[model samples]
Target: QEHGVSGMFTAPTAIRLLMGYGTEPAKPFDLHTLTRVFSAGEVLNPAAWEWMQKQLFHDRVPVVDHMWQTETGGPVFANPYGVSLLPIKPGGAGIPLPGIYAEIRTPEGAALPQGEKGIVVLTRPFPGLTPTIWADPAYIPHRLNGQSLNYQPPP
Candidate 1:
């Protein structure tokens, strides 16, 4: 608040800590200084999302969620902020960002239709990706070959 911070991207745990701090005994602080909060790295349960909305910001600031990992180097499923501000679904990660072609597949690799839970996979390349693992450069590619898959990360 001292620095006039307007937005932040953090894990759900951090938000929960701030929520705890705002309660009695601790000095009361207004969250209106914040305009947006982006969260990832864990499931933002519906109950927590509800608390973030009703109790945290009074439903004024948007709590956005996305899915990503160090390997992806960027978000595969995220709200396209610059393109447009889409509606928030309490516990849903927004649709795939432009240029990202992702799909869900069973443990055995068969594709599953939308709304079915499965492992997420990226079938196409995008920006900011490492081509090979650091420890074993040939391991990932060789394993893909053994599995009859040719998954290429972005250059």
Candidate 2:
């Protein structure tokens, strides 16, 4: 209407809020200026992506999927925009971004491989990562029985 803007970075929930307000995303809008869109916090569905693309992209609007728990403060793993995305499956957290280390482990402390989901572990501790429960920051890192998670202070 007045000031023209393009591209948006927000969560899937927020996008739904805008659509609920009766904003017609398709038909007519200066969508060409829009180049990118991102959704995180939860998951991004293909249906939602198609709707948004109609209203926002005349060409192609890359949808960057991100994943990170509050414990990580923000997205530590994300699909870089404009890159090859394996193709959006109905419900799936896209592969980790470059350099993100993810480990799937079990209560017994053995690492699980792909095609198996287990307790998630990180090889490198993110500075923003909360290492322990509240008021127990100094708790020692050890396995429940034998193998355990490893932790080390940065040099």
Full-model lDDT for every candidate: 0.73, 0.61
| Candidate 1 Cα misplacement greater than 4 A, ranges | 18-27, 130-155
Q: Which pairs, if any, clash in model 1? A: none
Q: Can you give the lDDT of residue 138 in candidate 2? A: 48
lDDT per residue for candidate 2 within 1-155, as digits (tens), equals 23555667888887666666544555465556666777887776665665565554532766666788877776666665555655554345576554356788997889988879788676665434655534345434432123333444333
Candidate 1 per-residue C-alpha lDDT over 1-155 given as tens digits, one digit per residue, 9 for 90 to 100: 67777888888777666666553532366555788888898767676777777776778888888888877887878777667889878778898876577899999999999889999888676544655544446645564666533445435
Clashing pairs in 2: none
How far residue 95's Cα lies from its native spot in candidate 1, in Å, is 1.1
Distance from true position, residue 74, model 2, in Å? 2.5
Model 2, position 155, has a per-residue lDDT of 31
lDDT of 2 at 39: 80
